[model samples]
Target chain A: MNREKVILLVEDNPDDEALTLRALAKNRITNEVVVAHDGLEALDYLFGAGEHEGRDTSVLPQVTLLDLKLPKIDGLEVLRRIRADDRTRLLPVVILTSSKEEQDLVAGYSLGVNSYVRKPVDFVEFTEAVRQLGLYWLILNENPGRV
Target chain B: MMDRLFSLRVRVLVLVLLAVVPAMLLMLLSARDRRDASEESGRARALQLARSVEVDYMHRIDTTRSFLAPLAQVFALVPNLSNVTQTACASFFDKLIANTADIFQVGVASTDGTVICRSPAGAESAASVAAEPFFTTAMNSRAFSVGHFEFESVTQKPALHVGYPIIGPAGTVTGVLYAALDLNAISTDLGKTADPSVSFITLITPTGTILARYPNPEQWVGKEVGTPPSLAAMESGGPGITRESVSLDGISVVSATVGLANAGASEPGAGSISALVSVGIPKDQVFAGINDRLRDDLLGLLAAALLAGGLGWFGSGVLLRKLQLYVGTTRRFSEGDLAARAGPPYPRNELGALGRSIDDMAVAVSERQQEIQRLNEGLEQRVADRTAQLEAANKELESFSYSVSHDLRAPLRSIDGFSQALVEDYADVLDDEGKQMLGRVRAGSQRMGQLIDDILQLSRVSRAEVGKEEVDLSVMASGIVDDLRRTEPHREVEFQAAPGLTVTGDRRLLRIALENLIGNAWKFTSHTERPQIEFGAEGGPGKPVYFVRDNGAGFDMAYAGKLFGAFQRLHAMDEFPGTGVGLATVQRVIHRHGGRVWAEGATGQGATFSFTLGGSS
Candidate 1:
């Protein structure tokens, strides 16, 4: 159960990725954190393409942390694609962005993002955000059954 | 020259008066001369009558003397003087009297002034004249003598006595012979004139006694003559006419008078003839002679004057009608009706030319005004276009600011996150200075993030859709102050918020603005020992100026000018730790609602933030 409890983080910025990983690690969230540097890469991993071509497409993560600013498919578009697909329609996705712009948050939520969170500029606040997210999604939140 | 300024009718009248007045005066003068000439002709006629009377009298006296001489011859040659008896003389005298109309009696008297044989004999005829002066003078002088005027006893008529003495063979006067000459026949002879056209012809004595008068010879033959008022000029036996003279019957007349003595009278009667012949014409009759021509000429002149006046009036009426129309046009044009035209149907003379000029000027002015109006209208469009361009530019700027704000936060977040991670992850290797430096970097990046957020908030409120509603500011202020207390729970701050404070505005924006105000008050009063904050709407109902007041360290009024400016701070950063954008955001939000915000406070004293919403309470 713990092995299957995985978290995916789609982020383009290396610093944000490193900081997010550090925060997750410092919070002792031992769930597997699958890191994708771009929205396309993350989509590829989620749909079992490219390097993860042979991976079981049905083995989905418990939660997806989507970053809005990306190199290839933006976060909102990825969420739209994910929601359009029957397999990932019920999956929980949280939007994470350095910009706390209201339009982005609203768009993310309208596109079926389960939650929206801003990347705090402070390490302590980021850690606490990560810890609470981990505790709720990895431990308490019930996940969809594998199709 | 002066007539030119007057209207045509007046000018016509004036010109006619000027031309006709002198001519009328000349006619009057000529008429007076004609009257005087008529009067002179009348005087000449009277002089002629006087001359005729004088010649007749002188001839009659000579004839009488000749007859007496013949008689003296006849009587002296008679051989028997005693044989010339009264019967013979009487028959001879009767024969002589029958031959002459003027001879009333012809008789021979004795040298002793005895009675003479008289024709148509009356009793005592010789005795009646026996003591007469003329008989005595004839007997004594023994020459022909004409006696004074007398009344014949038998005829009882005025007459004159002419006597001739009989001469003896010795050439001494023997007896006196005399004849009585009737003067009444003079008036009868005067009545035989060819025409009695003049008013009267009178023969007057020098004593103002009339001996004969014409046209009624028998009535005034022996009366006193009619006298003129100023007879001094004509009384000298001179021939003259007196204007405004009165006649014998007291009628006003133009009279001519002549002394009969001026006519050819011989020595016997030269100084003794005091008779005058007066021919007088009444002025009424004199004027009546030329009245028809005068009346006709005057009527012609009057008719001409009326014709001129009527022509002037009629012609001027036509001209003035057009002028009045032109006047109306001018008045309308002056009153700003540029479309007014002076003429459509008026005559095309000077007035019409003026009308056309006025219309042309009006057209030119109207065209110019239309051009100006078009320009003004174009100016409005240009202004609207310019405003639209400015609005587009402002829109571009707002979107740019929004995007800038959105993008700027990412780098600040990265910087702050990394700095904080370095301090936390590398805690064992970092010294106090390194850690503090990293902490400073974290704080600066975080502070920058906060400024970006605040700036974005201010910009958002600027462009935000104002969804107006009745927002209970009292509730909003209470909630904001409660949140502030919860945020700084350890602080001993007192808060008071009045209830039922209402206003109309966007609740979201108002909440943000009030939060800023309350937060500012809370932050500024942190140093006050007994800090009290009051959040309530002030002023009268329907218009409340909501204020968040706190007993805190206030700022000097000198810095009030910069109080609402972004990033402007009165206290040092360490003393009042904040992004310093709260009040700016508040001001922007309040301003977006068409309200304004201001603060007043002293150092270490309370500060108050007051704001007013637009239109609605």
Candidate 2:
């Protein structure tokens, strides 16, 4: 239980966060989920800065699931900061957002994100998307340092 | 195009020269007449000179014959005279010669060629003179005769010999009375009136032998001249005339020849007695008068050219100045100064009237331009006011459409999600009525959202800029039909699209317009047994009209005018499924392309929707 993979989720909306959590729980992914309310918290958790300061710098998250729209900093900027830092440059990142705007998906991937997944309006489709993401990123995807 | 280098003055000069050159050429033709006139004058002058000198030539023979004729009579009476009688006649001859020095000597010779008597005793040999042609001529004649010219032994000068026969009482010739007249005396007389620079006088025989000549007569007195035709003409007793030839000095000249009149002789042809007088002058001097005439002609031509050129130059300058003013006025008018006009009318003539016409035209143009300017200002103000009003309305419409798209979507999504949640989670507690109510809410919300989207697209079509391209409406109609068939594969439908129906318009907007049209056909044709939809372009009044005709449920003609309204529907929702904004979108698209759309239908007949891509057509 202590050796569980750390997963960072960046989202600002309460309903979207609840829905995503519900979807993840339904997909049977009981990982060490660190929910960041905004892009700033997400960046801090990944790079060990801001409120996540003094945390073990070597204890990196296995995957980051980012949302594009946020209160202060956007999810694309968080991904950009993570990619820019050498310690977190190779870390796996997946963009999850409610926006179907093509520009958001393009921007997220342009910042070195590993995946771009739209959070579907339909909960059933949303659950299925989360299941695939958890299966691929937590189990199938391999990272040499973390493994 | 006229080169700028040839100004008005230069062009006028050229115009003057155009006349001058031909005039000069014509004057040159007349100058030939002048040459001919000078030559005629030369001939006449030469003839006059020859006639004047020829009188002297005739008098020489006449004087000698006058005294000698009576003397011959006296000698004939004493045909057998002694030496005393001959000496007495010689003293009479000397007395006759004392009165006239032109008579050199007089003698009488016998038929035996012996000197019978001398006028001044011992003046000749008293031997037979039969060898002398004069003596032989006298012997042959019964009364009188003349002989050819020869050098007399006594005087050693060239002289003409005249002889008369002394007949005896038996009417037989006994001796000859002879006279030697000086030929140099005739030359001296001709030289009195002769101008050497103009001409020289000559006495020549019929055989072209020169007997005497004036002006250096010592050098050319007895030489044959080169002008034989003159000598021949004179010898033939031709009238006084001139001919071209060379003189004895080998210089080119025209020689005039006249037969000298014999003196007191009954016949001029007797013994071919009369001498021929001729005059010759150089050709250059004869034609020299023409050079003065040509020089005067040159001066006159120059004066004429200057007069015409100066007049033309001044006139052209005046005309060009007026033209320049006209140009300046035109330029100012073109530059948008509507008040500018060419002024100051000219008098009544072609060029003057042209200047007046320019001013009149400029005034008209200025008035028209001022009117146009006023109209343009009014139009521009109207356009500005209309544009601002349009911009305001557009801004309001944009925000309304944006709010419809952005703000309304979230509520719609929430309504749909909540309704779905109610159906799923409260299925046990909710009765059929309750579930139906929630479903109606969800359905109505989704329909409203679809309406919003269609309305937004309509607004977008109005705002968008048109990009024109060659669009095959046939191909596009076929595609929409295929999509419709794919969406409802069980709905058996027959669709006909005219092949190669092409036009230039925005492809995307035209496709949207076509979709709405064909989609309406599809929806409206649902109740028909065999739904047939046909799309085609047909020749219309001013442009090709495209129509979508369907064998489907159609509206009453009374409501046709309201057919393209946003919510206006021809069919009940239970019968035909549509948001009722489809035709509105089609109208918007057609209007965006600056085209028109209309519908024609009856209650039961199929409907036909027609449109023209050509604006106002």
True contacts kept of each: 0.59, 0.00
Q: What lDDT tens digits, residue by residue, belong to model 1 across residues A1-147? A: 355668899988877888888888887777788999888898898899888788887888889999887887888899999999888898889888876767788888899888888877776888889888887777777886642
- Runs in model 2 lying further than 4 Å from the true structure: A1-147, B1-14, B48-56, B76-80, B85-92, B117-126, B168-174, B193-198, B207-209, B224-227, B233-241, B249-252, B260-274, B281-288, B306-363, B380-617
In candidate 1, how many Å is residue B108 off? 7.2
So what's the TM-score on candidate 2?
0.52
Alpha-carbon TM-score of each model against the true structure:
0.70, 0.52
Best by lDDT: 2
Model 1 C-alpha lDDT per residue in residues B1-617, reported as the tens digit of each score? 22443465577668878877887787777777777776677556655655666667667667767766787788877654545767767877887778776777887777777665667644355464557666766776666666756567777777777777778888777677788777777667766752555677676665666667776767777676445333455554444445557776777776666554422223423354445567676767766665665677678877887787777777777776667777788889899888888757646688777878888888889999999999999999999999999899888977687567657876776788777777777999999999999889988888877777787787777777888899888888878877877887898788888888877889998899888887877888888889898987777886778788888888887788788888888888899888778778888888878887887877666777888877556
Clashes of 1: 7
In candidate 2, what are the lDDT values of residues B1-617, reduced to their tens digit?
A: 13552376687898889889998998898989877887788788877777877766666667777878887777778737544366676777677777666667777776786775665655755466678766665676465667777667776677787788878889888778888887777778767767866567888766556677877888877776554564455445566778777766777776677876543244555335356787888887887678877889899999988888888888777777777777777788778776767676764567666667766877888778779999999999999999999999988887666555645655655566567667877899999999999888877877776777777777677787788788999999999999999999999999999898888889888999999999988988888999999999888546888999998998899998889998888778888877888888899888877789999988768899999886432
Interface RMSD of each: 2.0, 4.0
Sort candidate 2 into its docking category.
Answer: incorrect
lDDT of each: 0.75, 0.76
C-alpha lDDT of residue A44 in model 2: 74
Which consecutive 10 residues in model 1 chain B have the weakest lDDT in total?
B261-270
Query: Which residue pairs come into collision in candidate 2?
Result: B90-B119, B113-B128, B113-B129, B113-B130, B114-B127, B114-B128, B115-B127
